[model samples]
Target chain A: MIRSLAELKAQAKELGPRRCVVAAAADPVTLQALSSAQKEGIAKGVLCGPADKISQAASKAGVSLDGFEIKDCPDEEAAIVAVEEVRASGDFLLKGHLPTSSFLGAVLDKEKGLRTGRVLSHIAILEPASLGRLLLVSDGGMNIAPDLVTKLDIINNAIEVAHSLGIEKPKVALLAAVEAVNPKMAETLAWAQITQMAARKQIAGALVDGPLALDLAVSEEAVKIKGVKSDVAGKADVLIVHDIAVGNIFAKGLIYLGGAKACGIVAGAARPVVMLSRADDAETKLNSIALGAVASVV
Target chain B: MIRSLAELKAQAKELGPRRCVVAAAADPVTLQALSSAQKEGIAKGVLCGPADKISQAASKAGVSLDGFEIKDCPDEEAAIVAVEEVRASGDFLLKGHLPTSSFLGAVLDKEKGLRTGRVLSHIAILEPASLGRLLLVSDGGMNIAPDLVTKLDIINNAIEVAHSLGIEKPKVALLAAVEAVNPKMAETLAWAQITQMAARKQIAGALVDGPLALDLAVSEEAVKIKGVKSDVAGKADVLIVHDIAVGNIFAKGLIYLGGAKACGIVAGAARPVVMLSRADDAETKLNSIALGAVASVV
Candidate 1:
């Protein structure tokens, strides 16, 4: 199991550099992050944007664009070309300097898009300084309010990421406010149904339980004190939140309040898509690129 | 502003004792707790239960029954008598060794109950070792799944408690998973509506904002980093949750995970009701009783 981001970065180094196609890669911070990842030998990407401007931005960020492919294209055409690069032969896709809508549209394009007929979801990996393992939180960046089927797909996407990272079995806790399936709390009801479904082998490769409170999902002492009984009571590797708001808030809470390091990627696509927050520190962005390298294989 | 449970205890000492009626007070722990309060001059109460048994239990618990009123009623009638005691005296009510359902039934009785046509809600006060002031979380124990109106009442009930606690303008944060009023997230929508209500002075005596994630409610650094602008951001005294599950889980999370000391009481009744959990430590229970004393006047 990958315990820390340090270990995750080590794993990415072992996986070596991948052909990471950067969609509209003109943003200075994005170019700098990609340059750092390239220097670390975890990734070598094709920057699909106006080449001269990309170089200028890279120069402004004090990063060299040497030893990297620069595809000369405008922003709108660059996104399509980068998506095609990843769809044709590259290992992963990285959205850079493009409007989120434009980038996502190019990836979701019907005929030329990198679609695998699965609902795409974002997975955030947080490594708390104290917790010995990485905590995976999902759908925080996509799918505003997913239904049962969509939630199932979201869980599957996370499980696949776990599998890609070499976890044979990841304990997934579907987070609600509580563990009981109360008639009034819809998250509990949904978790109960999904837990039953996972029990019946509908969602495989992960040990799933819920609707667990945040403490019950993460703290061993809470399980004993609350007298809660479950396989994934306090040792959850992944927390599948009910909706995008919950997922986003929870991931940010852990980062901002808990002082944890975080990285994020979009899953359920044909390839891993590196997507880091704009204000994220360099280590976080590099770890995201490392995650992209690791999740690129599957 | 109450800084700590110890401070709350000191405040209770300064307020002097009020008439507090305990229903079915034959249980040893209940009598012991009440006896200690009585000794501190923070409570004067009628123990409504069988006399001889109550005396025996009190003796076993090393508590004296001197200088107090005792109603010789069986378990079934003890709850009713206790409710009537509060109704007639207009003081506070405390649940003793009686079953929760029975005690609550008596409080909700149509003709003789302590109901004031307002929905009863539980308010949990947490004073973290690090926080400068108390955090109030409401409706965790009562109102399983409240509607928008019930939520508004819950907020009002919390506001009433804040007013009694001498907070002229308490900052209230209606907690959701995110700060945005996203149409897809129902919790955010509800918080937005209630926030507008608070803004319109429909719910007075509080500076209200939402939907705020937990981090934004308590952490000033998070507010600055997120660049969120609101009156209740980063300095909330009261947190009005979406439903019972959210409130209960959050309070427990702070207690079990964040190492916060918590005390809870039932508010929005004719008289404040002490309803601490049985597993609560003695100090927490006493603080809850103190909270009941403070909120009873409002």
Candidate 2:
């Protein structure tokens, strides 16, 4: 199994030099990250945007695009062209230098989008400084307040990503404020329902448990202290939250406060979609590209 | 200002040996922590439980009750007796080994409780390993899903605690999944309303901003990258989450994964109420007592 980001990058390098098609790839940071990924043999870049803008971005970032393939397109048509290119032959898609709504608009386009009949969710893979293994937090960036069906899709997407990382059967923990199902807390009730469904094989390919507090979901000491009996307690591979706020804050807390290294990608699409944030560091962008390369292979 | 947990403990010791009344003070961990705090001159404990159980717990934990004042009472009456004692003479109240509901029942009792005409909220004071200063997170363990008015009270309560910790004009950040006030996300709308309310002096004693993501709330780098113009963007003294799930997960994530030192107490009562979890370490328990001692002074 890929235990850390280092191992993940190494695995991606071994399996790759996969084609990563970038939509509106005229951002200096994106050029720099893709250039580094290409140099490391993780992915080969197919930069899709206006040729002049791509060249300007590469020069500004001090990056060499000798081994890259450039596709010239107008600013408004960049996302559509990139999506069509990926659907025709390219491996995965990456967003760069564009509004999120515009880029997502192209991806969700009815006739020419990467639709898989499943709800699209964002998965963040984190290598917390305190934990030896990689942890996955789901739907933090994509789903605002996911309902029960959407949460199921989010879990499935996370499990798929874990499988690509070589985890045979990921343990999924549904996180809430407390372990027990409180009548007033609606999330707890939803989690309890999901847990029951998982037990009955309605959710397959993972050991799923629910209504766990953050501590019990990740800490063995907390599990023992609380006397919680669950397969996922203290050893969860994926944490599924009810809403975007919880997942986003939880994942970002680990990264900003815990010194965790993180990379994120959107799943449930026909192809892996790497969405880079301007605030993300260079290392995170490269790691995300590597994650996309690996997730695309399967 | 107290920048770290060590500094917090020192300040507590300097101002204290304040009287702390313990409800159901028969838990081994509680006895041990209180003994250490007493020795450190943080608090003078008044153990309010059956003398026999207290003695047994102290001996089991290798603690001495030499300087502690024992108030022998049945388990059922321990919380009420402790509340009454604190109302009469003690500086603060500590929950030792009782169910949280029972202990809070006494604190929230209409006639005999420590009512201050404000909604009670739990504030977790964290000394994150990555940050040099203390960060306060509110309503994580008390209010489940608070409305706009309750959130205002929660923010006010946190501001009071920040003041007690010597932070003048604390900067409060209302946390959300994103910085923009999207109409689709109800929490973001509420946060925007709260921000406006703070601007109008409806919520006083702090500089408050809303709809900030976790990174933008704490990281100057994120603020610089996003170009967010706000006083509380990068220097938030207090983080106000929308619900218990978000606050709980965020705080515990920092503690378990970020290696933060935390101690929590319920604010808005007449006296600070220290509520330590069983899973907390010895140092955390002691720090909580110290926090109670300091927060009780004002």
Candidate 3:
């Protein structure tokens, strides 16, 4: 229902300030984004990084975080502490100066991390004029070449995140090169299996269809033109990518070249994780925060 | 330099009518698009399908083809005949009614098919306003789960097509989940090798860099923000996808949900093959033909 990013922000503001637990937030851009988000009343900052670097970054970015909480810790320790903190009291977790390995390691920690017996995957929300909806693309960051079962978890994770964004009964398209299953094209084969599983009440909460090409899944006209019949065609709310490399490039292609606005989050955790890139605009970072906040509430 | 789809078509017209040989030319949209191209002096069509069916399709689309050539052939033999005809006289090929399997069968035929010793691939033109450039995504339609060597061919093929589009030295972004190369990530490994190859002039005609995420590849601001330094970070002309399934879905996600206008063509062939789907608009189909026209000449 949000017509524009501005409206999405307004909706974000109404949800109240989000509690973000930042891990090793020592980078200037990371701090700057967090500072901006805080100023916009989108999120309340919980900085967990090397205290000296964090404060220096804040000062360099001309941000006075007198009201912000700075939890001093080394990068590795910050990752662990941040996740633990978020799991205990915060609404969401964010990565900062820590290495991605350590940052993720902390979150995937069996005892203290936020695991929900589900696959942790990255989903990007992109708004392109071509589709006229907030499209979600998944597993671009976390999962590599996922097997059939991992794909099911990825889809379920994306659907839960979509529901959090208030899209009830999301149309899920398992993308492949063709509409029919081919043994050589593993993606189509996987799509066929997933569709069957969804039909058999295996993957729940989303309408699943696949072995669909990119054009067919999002363009109803393409569907009609191809004489392809599917409930999810041209109306897909979620596009489950075949692999991380493809998803990563495909999602980025849209945002960078396709005039799309995007925000990202790692889903299927006990609590949602904000993984908005430093490259994302303030609006995108804020939207991601809003997305994470919404998902957290859900 | 062309801004919109209209400009792309005008540019196509400036270059003169293209010579196209369409296999299984019984689809109405294909006929209509070709008819428009003919009317606008964008392309010269050689219809290769069942003669009656081609005529019927032309009539169905309300197009009068008084000066066109129609090659009568059954769907089973249409692909081979179309490939052979195009190789002999036509400039490019188009998919019409035949299945992709059959169409590709003729294209990959050992002796008669249009094989140039390079793997055939699909490169989609994505025009997203934020970047203000025609972004090319490849291997989304033809190659499935390409290995390192095949990835090289895909990049080479995409680079060739990019050069034909007047992007003399296109920036090729080898995308992955993150910018850094990780041993666990196969895409990053491939990207690292590809970047080195491009640097050493093994892969010519493009500025290639990667192990980059979506944002870093296209958003220069993101490059600075993330401090991820690379020449291709924010100005990638071509994004070489890992496989067809990912490329297909990723491109579609942009067109359908990100508000982008896309034109798809099979590149890295003897001649670029424009396969406009029945779902694409007149402009998309025409633009693809224009792209093919330019690519064919190169």
Candidate 4:
């Protein structure tokens, strides 16, 4: 139901301020976005990086970080220590100037990571022109070639995100090449299994079905015409893709070619994480921040 | 280059009159579309069905088929005979008032069917709002888990159709989840092989590259920023998909969600074949007939 960034901001305000910890927060764009979020009362930031670099970025970006906490960490290791600090202090995590591998390593660090024994996934919430509601596309940025069990985790992570968005019993579509189970297509096989699990009440609080094409999943008319019987077809809130590559392209297509508005996050962690791309516009970044803040509370 | 159906009609005029054989052509929509085409001198139809039924439908649709050829045949054998007649005399084939199974059975029959050894593939030519030129999406309606060879066939089929549309040396993007040649993703591996084949000149008359996500393939800015190099990156004319379901959904997404105009055909066969969907508009069906007529000549 969230239409624009302004609406998301209004929603976020009602949820109060969320505390966020930035790992290796030395990048100008990163600092700018975080500072903007903080100034807008969307989130309160705890910047973790080299103290001097963080201030320089803040100054260069023309963002005043007065009264905001800045935790000085020499490098990535310090970022990890700061991550631990913020996690214990009830603040969400964000990546900054650090390499993606290093940042993720710290988050997945067996002993000190934010893992709750669930497979981590990324979900992109897209507002396309052809639809009246938001669409949740999952695992496009994470979990490549996940097994059936891992897919369960991915679906659950996306469902949790949908639940946070106030969609009770979110409809989930397991995407495949065809709507029928085929021995050759592993995605279809997995989709069938997943649909069965949801039907048998193994996976609770979601109406699940597949293997649906993109059209059948989103268009109720297409569903009726195609004679696809399921609770999720034509009104899918979540589209659980077969692989990272499919999800990645599917979500990106909605944005670049389909003229859609999108915001993304790394889900299945203990806390909601904002993971906006650097090339994303100000609105997208802010929308994602708002989503992270609201989702964290939910 | 066609922004709408009106533009497509203008283009169809220059392509000359296409010979179309409509099987079981007793449907009012089909007759109306055919009459419109005839009035514009874009197509000449050979209607095959019960003669009385065809005349009644034509009259009801406010069409006079005085100049059109009506080949009398029973309802049960009309589809097969029409396909055979077209295969022998006409340039293209159109579907009307027949089950898909029956029509496809005749087209795929080894002895009398139109078979060229290559796997029959469906190509949806879309004109997206974000794109200046047409986008050819393939295997959405046919082919399931195409192995490396079948994928090559699909690519070849799409390339052939694009070539018939006057696109010499089309830029083909073999789509996947990512741009890298990841061994874990089977689609990427196939794309890498296909790319190599194109590089070695095994796949001729096209510039092929892959494992590109939809964004990188269509957005030159994304390709430049990501440092992904390929001739087909930003100007892909043909999109060789991984599977039928994905291709189908992708094409439909462009149409329903992105407001794209497209003409579909089953390519790599003995002759150009039109297979317009029931969901398609009159213009879409007419454009497909035009495409079939043009492809048949090549």
Candidate 5:
């Protein structure tokens, strides 16, 4: 299994280079990361944007785009061309130097977009310096406030990503404020329902448990102290939150306060979609590229 | 200002000893923490429970109870007696070895309880090892899912605690998944409303801003990167979450993964309530007692 981000990059390198198509590829940071991934033999670059703007970005980033294929186009039509390129022969997609709405608009276009009849969700893969392993948290960026059915799709997407990382049967934990089902807290009720559904084989290929607090989901000592009996209580492979705020805040808390290294990708799409934020560091962007390359193979 | 948990404990010691009454005080860890606090001149212990059980607990904890005042009572009436004692002369209340429902039942009693016509919320004070400062998170333990009105109460309670810690005007951040007001995300709408209310003087004594992601709330680099312009974008003293799940997960993620030292107390009560969980370590229990003693004075 890929236990760390370093191992993930190594695995991606071993899988050979995959084609990464970047829409509106005029951001210096995106060019730098893609250049690094190409140099490391993890991805082949396909840049789609205005030629002058792409040249200016590559010069600003101090990267040489010698072997990369460039598709010159207008700024408004960059996303369309990039999506079409990925549909034809490219392996995955990346968002760069464009509004998220416009980038997603092209990807979600009815007749020409990459659609799999599934809800789109964001998954964050983190390797906290103190935890000694990789952890997956989902729906932190894509879904705002997901309902029960959307949460099920988010869990399924996370499980698929985990399988691609060589975890055959991931233990999924539905996070809540407390372990018990409180009627006043609506998320707990949904988690309980999902747990039952997973037990009955409605959600297959994972051992799913619900309504666990953050401590019980990760710490064996907390599980023993609380006397919680569950297969995923202390050794959760994936954490699924009810809404975007919880997952977003929780993952960022680990990164900012806990010194965790993290990378994120959007799942439940036709191909892996790497969405890098401006605040993400260089390491996180490169790790995300490697993660997308690995998940694209699956 | 109290920049760290160590400073918080020192300030509590300088404020002299406050009378702390623990309901059903037959837990070894609680006795140990109370004994340490008493030795440090942070608290004067008033143990309210069965005499034999308290004695056995003290012995198990290897602590001396010579200076403590023992209120011998039956197991069923311990919470009632403890509440009445705190109402009569004690400074604050603590939950020792009883069910939380019963303990809260006594505190929320109509006739002889610690009620101030305000809603109760939980506030956690954390000092992440890397941050070099203390952060306050609210409504993580007491309120499950709070509406806008309850959030107002929670923010006011946090501001009061901050004032006691020497911050005259605390910067409060209403945490959400993102900074923008996305109509699909219900919490952003509520945060925008709260921000306007704070500006209108409906919520006083704090510079309140909203809809900030975790990174934007704490990291100046993130604020500069995103070009976010807000008074509380990067230096938030108090973070108010919309629900218990977000706050709970965020706080625990800091403690377990970030190597942070944390302590929590329930606010919006007549007196601060220290409610330690079984999963808490000895240092956390002691820190909580010191926190309760400090907040009780306000």
Candidate 6:
């Protein structure tokens, strides 16, 4: 029932400070975001890149690195070091300037990684101006073309995040273009299977239903107009997309065109991960940290 | 380019009148629409249904049956008779009170109906007040699970409709959830293939590109923000959907939630087909007829 990003931010504050370890923390924007998170008392972080470069970035961004600890490693080794640090402390793994693939590779390393027998899926939570609720879209950044099992993992990952955000029973919409199970559309078939699975208590911690269009999933007026009867209709917490493309485009579209703000994280690990795109504005960056910090508590 | 639905109506007016055959035209909304279209000189229709019932319905809706030619047949026989009438004239086929399944059965009838070599697809044209252009979405009503070949036909149909609206070289954005062609997401792969096909002149008569998200397809600012460079990135005339659901949901969302007016027609037929749902308002009904009128000129 946290309807707005402002409410989410306040809740993150209520959760107090969680620690974050940033890979390739020499990036000025990342340092600025971490600094802002620290200032807001949502998260504190260990910068795991070259100390000199980190210092320079902090200075460049007009941030004080005084109280913050720098692990002092070669920049290329930062992701590896950061992953181990986060794994040891159970703190959040925040990505900085490192390529996501390199950062994630270390995190997914079988021996010294943060795998929790679940898929590492990306979740972007949007607070659309009109929707008046946090809408979670998953795997837009990870798991390019997931099979049915991978999709189940993606849903579970998002549900965990939604639960952390205090949505006790998240309404997960397995979004397709429509609500019917058509043989031609693979996503609808998947949704039909998933819906039954949820009904049978297979996919727990969420009430999932779909093959819902964007409107039917979010707008009450549309639900009435279309006369679709469902508890999730006009009220969905998470939109489990058909694939990476659908989730990616939808997340980007809401942010860019629909006048919405978003926070993104990689879930299904031992701890939550923050990997805000550099293209994301400062507010989005800060929001990601708050979301990561709050979720890391669980 | 014809940007508004008003412009679409004017164009239909300029094309004069196209003969439309209405199956099961005994419904009040049906005859009302046909009567208004005749009054506006947009269409002259053959109403194939029980003459008495059609007249009564017309009177109830305050419409005159003076101009439109009526075929005195039982309501059950109307769909058959109307299909034959539209087929012979090679004009528009308007659905009245008939079940869509029955109407489509006649249209898809191999021996007698109006089956073009191409697949029959439904296109919804929206003149969003904010976007300021007619945006086309296909297969929302017809085509449950169209394969790549059927999708191609759908695109071609939409392009033809775009042409009728004065867009010479329509920018067709094969809309998926994301821009990246992830191996797992079938729609993205289809888009990538279609984009290459367009580049190779395999699919001509339009500049097609994809795996575009909604924002990148329609917003110039989003294109620059995301650093995606494509001719179809900012301005798209048509959005070729993954299947019926994407088109259905997106269109309904924009209209119900985003405050947009829409006109829908089924294309890729020998003649255009208009099937306004009972949920559709009066203006939408008239707009559909206008769009069909203009498209039928070809």
Residue lDDT tens for model 1, B40-119 = 88888788989988998988998889977998988789999999888888478889887788889999998889787788
Model 2 segments beyond 4 Å from truth?
Answer: none
Compared with the real two-chain complex, what DockQ does model 3 have? 0.60
Q: What are the clashing pairs of model 2?
A: A258-B258
lDDT of 2 by residue, B100-149 (tens): 99999999899999999899999999988868899999879989999988
TM-score of each predicted structure versus truth: 0.86, 0.98, 0.86, 0.93, 0.97, 0.89
For the predicted complex of model 5, DockQ is 0.84
Best by lDDT: 2
The weakest ten consecutive residues by lDDT in model 5 chain B span B126-135
Which DockQ-derived CAPRI band holds candidate 1? Answer: acceptable
For model 1, name the residue pairs that clash.
none
Candidate 4 backbone clash number:
3
* Model 1 lDDT at residue B192: 87
| Residue B246 error, candidate 3, Å | 2.4
RMSD of each: 3.6, 1.3, 3.5, 2.4, 1.5, 3.1
Which sections of candidate 5 miss by over 4 Å?
Answer: none
Model 6, runs deviating above 4 Å = A59-67, A213-215, A221-228, B13-18, B32-45, B59-68, B88-91, B176-189, B213-215, B225-229, B249-260
Give the TM-score, chain B only, in order for the candidates.
0.97, 0.98, 0.94, 0.94, 0.98, 0.96
Q: What digit string (tens of lDDT, one per residue) describes model 5 on residues B2-41? A: 9988999999999999999999999898998999999999
Report the poorest 10 consecutive residues by lDDT, candidate 3 chain B.
B1-10
Instruction: Give each model's clash number.
Output: 0, 1, 11, 3, 0, 8
When 2 and 3 are scored with DockQ, the better candidate is 2
Report the C-alpha lDDT of model 1 over A101-220, residue by residue, as the tens digit: 888888889899988888899999887656678888887779877999999989999999988777779999998766778888888889999999988999899899999887789888
lDDT-best of 1 and 3: 1
Query: Per-residue alpha-carbon lDDT of model 6 for A40-110, expressed as tens digits?
Result: 98887888999999989989999999668789999889999998888887479898998878988998889
Runs of candidate 4 with Cα error greater than 4 angstroms are: A1-5, A182-184, A227-229, B1-7, B52-64
